[model samples]
Target: MIIPVDQLNPDTLNQVIREFLMRQGEDWGLAEGHLDDAIQQARDALVQGNLVLYWDENEESLTILSKEEVNQSGLG
Candidate 1:
């Protein structure tokens, strides 16, 4: 399911982004202090409609994905 960014609590959204960034840290070579920047970039993408928030009911999990990815996967 597609999750609307405006429908989520700000704190919850930030936490989710934080977790996702932590997982991506290796690939991003993200330093501890640089997390905020990364988060902002992710948030910007979300606001710009370049990224999406997805909720998978079966897995009971949420994931952040690119708009193209969602379209390609037929999840949107």
Candidate 2:
């Protein structure tokens, strides 16, 4: 299930983005240095609808994904 970023509290939204960055491991670029900046970037993506939050109901895991991924996964 996909959750709207707006549906989350500010703190929870930030935590989700941070966790996603950790899991991405530099895949989206430089997950190591300047954590705050990276997180802000992710937040911007979410605000712009370029990124979305996905909840894996069965596994009870949460993740961030691009708009294309959401579409491809039929979660959009």
Please give, for residues 19-62, the per-residue lDDT of candidate 2 as tens digits: 88888758656645777888899999998989988888888988
Candidate 2 similarity to native, TM-score: 0.86
Please identify model 2 stretches exceeding 4 Å from their true place.
none
lDDT of 1 by residue, 1-76 (tens): 9999998999999998888888878644486568888889999989898989999999999988889999999999
Model 2 residue 4 lDDT score: 82
Model 2, C-alpha of 52: deviation from truth (Å)? 0.4
lDDT of each: 0.87, 0.86
TM-score of each: 0.89, 0.86
The 10-residue segment of model 1 with minimum total lDDT is 24-33
